[model samples]
Target: MSLKRFLDRADESRRSLLVANRSSPDPILNVLEATFDDQPVRVSERAVPDVETDTVLLVEDGEVLATSPLSALRDTIVTVNSDLYRTGAMGIDDLDMPAVLERLDDVRFTLRGYPKSNTEKLLLVVVSRYIEGIAWQAGHGRHRASFQYLSRIKDERGTRRVYERLAETDVDVHVYGRPDWVPSERFDVTTHVGHDADFRDSWVVLFRPRPPTPDANAPDSPSTDHDPVALLAIETEPHVWEGFWTFDQSLVADLDAYVAREL
Candidate 1:
């Protein structure tokens, strides 16, 4: 009975969460799968210097909220947004916090590409001006078999909550730190994607929880008594066989079960 309720709630949450800005689906390329039945041969990275062979573009942004700093990210195959779009919105210096929060909650943020190098970290410094509140997000391009298999129904924010709890039980669990990102950093954060960040044949993507800020009525009140935490991360991978899945079905099942039990 509890499992049924959990599933229902998860579905409803997925629908409601993307209510305002769910129209568009802009995903970065994460997988590199190729097939040639004729020649029966194709090229893929992995031997070494895989990241270098994959010539990809990145989009990044930084924002400074009340008393906190944050940086948002998106990486894609093609370049998105010119220099002006990224440099303009350094931090909410003059915008109304109430209005800004409302805009963010609505998910109207435009994709500006993901961070590729440490150089972009300079833009994060702008967050120093804000009074409080911080949140950062990023979308790794392409889908590997490992990443795409994650829970589809959960929002980015919910994923954070899931990971945090799982950390108690799982090993090598590296989640978002800095107590909610930091100032003068590409993403206000740097989640450890495990020691072996290999997602070639599979898919890997990341999401973060929505930033918690004071409400219009209560300027100091936030969603929780404490700060936000990076929780769950869902990943999807392809199947090895023509129709069979390539990822560890047991692990994927565990993730599904975990979400069912928790959120």
Candidate 2:
């Protein structure tokens, strides 16, 4: 299946974030609403005591799925910018993402990168790094990521350091993009170069946990509890993209297989 089709396969459910008993300033809530403007998520504030003051609750179908301190949400999401990621100012180890952020998985989104506006693309960038951080922690998964152009790997210091560190691990790291720049010997990744439309217009980051031993009773067998995760985005126009991230094990496995077989 195509990347666009994968995005289309997202579940049709919607989610809401209720800033309950918020003692935070109005600007913080405003930023939260603006960040999710075009997505399927609804952000609102209330004065009810259903939750503690200064906390945000993620609800779907009238059930509270997850909650995080409003201050933590502000620190993790609202007050960030794209430069911290692109400029290598914020490393993967420095990411302390709130649980509410991770709970956004499976929701489809539309964002704009760079020259259009700053806030929209930060969400995707955050999710991309979060997936990378998971792979880094697992240390033995097969990770695949794509940049529209290969030069980004060499040009962005933070991006370069991230791949370098992953290569240092046992993880089989694979990168896809247009061959704008060749990686140095320090980068131990398998490079897949192409000039096709997919190479020029897609952003993907995926991590599939190492396969478990057939014999579960073996002492040396690894745990199979780790689930596969992925993020897929396709540029529909210059600077504008539509995408989604998921933690569904089967879907991640299928997407990983598709990438291995094609593009």
Candidate 3:
């Protein structure tokens, strides 16, 4: 569903505020633009309105962040700099918070804190993970479960039973370059099996013999014979490769499949 519809079902309380305004607007008046210590926040020119009237709390990254007035934030501009995108750069491949926050200037975040009296404070988050990539399959069109609960299906590593299945079937399953984002664990992450074209953050799925040609029900669609090729929702950069490792690193793991399955 669209963001608007999602927000409609988000919550009822509109007590908290999320002054989600980004970029530079007009200078502030009474709210002095604090020097270095206290960063200044700006109010937009237009007023925000809500069909339903109620105090709502705002939250982000599983934390109570701010309280917002639904109607006061229509076209209001919020002043911010680096304090915006603070999602710690754990081990992520890309850390484009600055660019993202700048581009998504219109989007707003929820805010919340304590309750006025009886109402219980409600927290809500508006995070998302987009998926738009193709998966590489073995020549036999199947493999064991290797990426079980993988935090990011796109960034697969270490040997898995799936590869063992490919070996048992004697099929070549490989997707070149890094894969697009996929469902992993609970959050989202990048993959190393698919690619667009340029061959930067590409993924690869490699095995013996070439992958079988696609038949009916293939991701590429009615036009069968779609061998293992890069499947991107968008056109990618041009690329070419010579050969890859034929050996599978997960042979030993797959040896005890029956016993493992019992677990």
Q: Which one is best on TM-score?
A: 2
Q: Write the per-residue lDDT of candidate 2 for residues 158-254, one digit (tens) a residue.
A: 8888888899998899999999898877779999999877788889999998986677677676666667899999999999988888999888888
Worst 10 residues of 3 by lDDT: 124-133
**What's the true lDDT of residue 37 in model 3?**
13
Q: What is the C-alpha RMSD of each candidate to the true structure, in Å?
A: 18.6, 1.9, 20.0
TM-score per model over all chains: 0.19, 0.94, 0.17
Which candidate leads in lDDT? 2
Clashing pairs in 2: none
The residue-by-residue lDDT of candidate 3 on 1-263, one tens digit each, is 11122122222221222333323333431121221011112222222364133222243443434443332222122232111212211111122122112222113222221332111101110111000001123334322222212333333331222232234443323222333434333321222332223234222221222344566776673432322221111112222111111122242123223212321
Alpha-carbon deviation at 253 in model 3, angstroms: 33
| Candidate 2 off by > 4 Å | 214-222
For candidate 3, the per-residue lDDT at 148 reads: 18
lDDT of 1 by residue, 39-72 (tens): 1112122222322222221111322221111111
RMSD (CA, Å), candidate 2 to true, equals 1.9
Give the candidates in order of TM-score, highest first.
2, 1, 3
